[model samples]
Target: MANDEAAIKSYLAKYKHRDFTTREVMSLIQVYRSLTYRLEVFVFNNGTRKNLLNLEGTIPVTYKGAVYNIPVCIWLMDTHPQNVPLCFVKPTADMTIRVSKYVDSNGKVYLPYLHEWNPNGSNLMKLVQSMIAAFGELPPVYSKPRNEMPMPYPPTFPTTFPHPQYPSQPGPTFMPHVRPTAEMPTYPNFGLPYPHPGTANGSQFPTPANPLPYPTFNYGSSPEVAGGTITEEHIKVSLLSAVEDKLRRRLNEQSQQSQAELETLRRTAQELQEGKMRLEDILARLQKERSDLDKNITILQEKEKELQSAVERLGEQEGVDVDEAVVTTAPLYTQLMNSFAEEATLEDAIYYMGEALRKEVIDLDTFLKQVRTLARRQFTLRALMQKCRQKAQLAC
Candidate 1:
């Protein structure tokens, strides 16, 4: 018995490393006799108490060096095969076993363990039957292979080594289960089936239920939510005031900017006006100078024509005297006697005599002085006209 207990303890230690819970370990021993031959089980914390309650009347026994605690009633079944030894013991809350059979390649009937254990060519059926005989029934809970079944629950790990009694925050100690309130009053359910006792006309004033106070929302002066203790009209007035203030400030700024621009434009326009007037004055002065120059040119041309005509007349008079001097070289007194004798004889002889006498007596010095004075007048007039033209060009 000591050796069997040691072996069971050793196997249980191995199972502890595998992270199988006590319930899962017991289930395996119940379902598979192969595991029961060398099964080990242990309990810690609440698990030990739960196991004791499940196998209340069972006795602990030993097989092949391993100890098992199982119920005795399963051993009395006549249908169980004889060659297999009752080996396994299981402790659990519920006792009901499920089994399936399969034939091995050697044509032997075998019992499968859970959904995972391979019964083919392994004496699993005989082992499972022995476990059933010892345990009375398999544990109700079982584990299946990962590929073939869904997990019963999500995996978890120990959150604390030494668990704390109190949670981090205070939660509700007792929450009363509350029934929902009845709906609002309706017409048909308002005691309409009962006859009114007071009034003969069947009209009676119903007692009024107390009216609930209307909720008051105070949104303060924040512009976000529109509802408040303040009326909507007051809010609208405040909003309009704010908008008007903003608009007034913007308009003032715009007006100031516009006034500044207008002043600048006025100054610019004044400067342009002054410039235009100056240009007009200059244009008028140039035009007047041009007119004066044109008039002076016309007068100078007329004076030059007159001077040329006078010079031509003087040249003709001078040529008459020079021709007379070459034809009649005699004294003035002898030319007078030739004239009087020619008058008695011929008219042509008298005319030639008078012309010759007049030419021989004319003064050359006086004629030259008159020509020099006319040429000087022409030069002075031309110079005055040229000066006027240059002044006009400079103004332009």
Candidate 2:
């Protein structure tokens, strides 16, 4: 498990956001150990080349009670999660690409999930699960005829190892490169109904009963001696080879078991971490609200005490002066308010003078003269009021 994490971290060192992409790839491979990661030059539609990280492997899909490993490669862009990875089916020499609505002739995959990809919601693990489910419904590739042509030698390793020849072009074309040895995962049964064993045909061998054949050694007679006694060296070599093969198979199984257990622990730890963060956030918000509530309660208590003091003071006094109670904040405000009151009084005086003139209490010339003088005084007061309001920043 430590080695796996180290490898993942090393591969993700060149990514823009290493911390996030590392976690994503680690979790993905932990669950699907068959998948291997690599850095390769990805070619764009416009003939641009970029060295990018890609996870390549076969996901098992069950069809008609038999499970088939669907070879696939998912290419991650520099800004992964922000953009959907380019996915394609990678068929082997023994397999043929089966074109369908979901898969194009070039083996490029199209799905609703990829179309509606959300950075926060989508991930490699879910994408792989979706692929498995989709391929199960419609098998992507079928095995070619055995008699048409055969490989010179049977593969010693499982086909889960990614083929080295991934065409650099935009299409999913296979070219030739030397294949590397990779350990086969003793896969846990996953998917709908059928589980992938990560072996050839998902079959198990019993204790290496028929180990790989070794050439018979004859030292005393013709090389074609049929009934010749085998030497101790040959016997020892045969026994060692058989034991080594058995130990290798055991180690592979144990390694996969350990990997599965480690993956489960990692998932649990992640869940606990998330829960801790949620609890911390909730606690912080609650603390802030509590502080605010305490402050409001203190203010209300102070207000109650002030109201009680006022009630007592009013009870003690026979009368309260409303004018004294209402105080202006500034001397300028006091002057402005006094000016408004005088202007209103002058308007009332002018109205009364006009009334007296209408009742013939004074002559027209005297009435006109008194009214003009009063009007001039009132206009002066109105101008002063307008200036005061402007100075006080109040609307006229």
Candidate 3:
């Protein structure tokens, strides 16, 4: 025991200096700083700044004819060489493809080289290289979706050209281009009478005292003024016709929908009447079944009374002598014992049969029929037993 203790202490002391000594951690840190400087790899844990040496870096790997820069990470446990650092290939958010089997959901990489690692033989450099090589089998891609083109502005009422007689001017007084009169226009009650044909508005009544609100007679700058252009008038008419057609179509659709709903309601009313009749029939059937059940209940009560009287008679005749009529039926009751298990008695069979009947394994009719048959046989057997010679040989 003393020798074993000495050996263990020496082994611990040997490892006490630590394989990853101050120099090694510092050297790893230097390597990481240089790599981060060159490759733009960052180090972090849950958004917390951390020592770059421990958990992050990048490795260059080659596949086919191209080379890739794979972001790599290392997790160092306090027990280090006793527990090797876990390495991972960390893909960024842009890597949209399905994860390959070589990597886990957490982005940790797996390779056979890791299993074969020896504390004396392998270092962080060699392990990372192995991961890079394993990753060459399937590579990650940084992809971005192409942007779609934007839509153009919506259409507006066409601008009309000014009449040649009236020269154009800066900011001429006019409302924004009004829709063509082809549409059915809603004019508010101007409170003044409409003008007559030769007059301003179409009303024969005298002009209003307000002079029809300033600029009310304002017109478009279009060369097709009052009635000089025939084509414009026809185009305006066509637009009015189109608007009227749309209004007619909507009204027709509403009427058709109303008709369809009325038809559905009519069918539903008929179905409900038929369903009411069917329910009435079902109710009548249930009433008939209830009456039949009441009759059956009265019959069962009568049988119960007869069973009580027979039980009283059986008690009185327990040891009485019987005659020849019962002797002829004795064999039937003896046959019942054969229906039981080899090691069982007639009492066990009867108990199990009663339990089965109670559990409804046999229906009420079948149970009642069996009981009537057994009762007659049992009574005959009892009578024959009473008549048996007390001197007869007993059977096993």
Candidate 4:
């Protein structure tokens, strides 16, 4: 560690006399100080003002014979002799080194005071020298150049034309173009003039004449006369003509009513035809169902009879009496009897048959209603028919 410190001191001494511009010195000081504290320096060129310096990771090498872990920035003044301000140590990897011209509250730029490094206090001289070695030279101060010469003035002009394009052209002419007439205007009067033709002025013209003359009843006058009297025969003829017109109107009205009634009757006939077709279909379906029921009843009766005979045979084989077995199977026999009971009186049987028929009709009506609903929903006829057959068998 002693050897490394001595080597850092020798390197810093070599850069102490180096010619460095103010900006370069400030950048090098930041890097040098950061390295002395064992903190890495990352130089970033912001492309404008002061170049930024970022402290990242750690600096393992010693600088100016001292070790530190804190990071800092060194800002340079813009004018005359360059100086720096002591900034707080940052714990982050990157920090901005702001270069600003110190200004008073009146907005005037002021030169910053130079700081002297104490060897016993902080040994900042060695770090500043090392910073000068790393960064080259400081930038020169800027100022505006002075201006000379006065501005030129524009020329003046008179308000009259100097020369004309067409010297012989005529001047503009002005005159009134319209002339008045001597005829007087006329206004219409509201009332008609008496003892005069059509106008209030005394002019010889036709007056306001009545459109129709009173009718006369003189048949003796000429038949081709322009204005003639009416006779009793003409009155009779006119009355007959009016009566004929009324009769024709009544006949036309009756004809229209009759045509409407005919149309209603046609619609009623169509509905009745459809109802008849539906009834025929229902009757056919009922007949088919009755046949199937009869077949099923016969099959069930045969099975029942076979079961009774088998029970009797089993009882006999077990040494039971035949009369006792018959008595025990009497209920089964009665059920079969009830199933085949066709000897009821015609009136009673007819009544029961009518009730059964009514029930079958009601079932058919319900089925038709279901079918219509399915049809309205666009279900296939074949599918509906299959479902209906399955449901009817299950009901049975």
Ranked by lDDT, top first: 2, 3, 1, 4
Residue 25's lDDT within candidate 4 is 42
| TM-score of candidate 1 to 2 decimals | 0.20
Off by over 4 Å in 4: 1-237, 317-396
**Which lDDT tens digits does candidate 4 get at residues 1-396?**
455444334433323322333233444435533332211221212222322222221221222322222222332222212223222211121111111222111111122121243223433344443333222121111111113111221143211111111111122111111114421111111122111223332223233253111111222332522333435664564456446544544674577678879989999999999999999999999999999999999999999999999999878875767545544235544443333232233234445545765778546566556545544433343344445445445332
Candidate 1 off by > 4 Å: 1-245, 310-396
Give the alpha carbon lDDT tens digit for every residue of 26-129 in model 2: 89877766677877676553455667787877676655545555667888777777767778776555554555446543466766677667888898888888
Candidate 1 residue-wise lDDT, 1-396, digit = tens: 355345444544433222222333344345422222233122323333111111112232233222333322111011111111112222122221112122111111122232222223224234444444433332211222223322121144221111111111121111112225431111111112211212232223221243111111222454433321335754565456446544544675577679879999999999999999999999999999999999999999999999999999888874456435655334543444344344334444334445555586435565445445554654554455455445445321
Ranking by TM-score: 2, 3, 4, 1
Give lDDT tens digits, candidate 3, residues 1-396.
Answer: 345334333433333334453334445544433222111122222232222223454454555534444555565433445445555544433232213444432344545656565666666666765776776766532322223122221244111211111011111121222335532221111122222122432223333343321111111232332333335654554455446544544665577679879999999999999999999999999999999999999999999999999999989874756433344445544443332222244345556678989898998788777767666665665455444433233342
Candidate 2 to native Cα RMSD, angstroms: 19.6
Q: Between candidates 1 and 3, which one is better according to lDDT?
A: 3
Q: Which candidate is the best by lDDT?
A: 2
- Give the range of the ten consecutive residues with the poorest summed lDDT in model 1: 159-168
Off by over 4 Å in 2: 149-396
Provide the overall lDDT of each model, using Cα atoms, as 2-decimal numbers. 0.35, 0.64, 0.45, 0.34
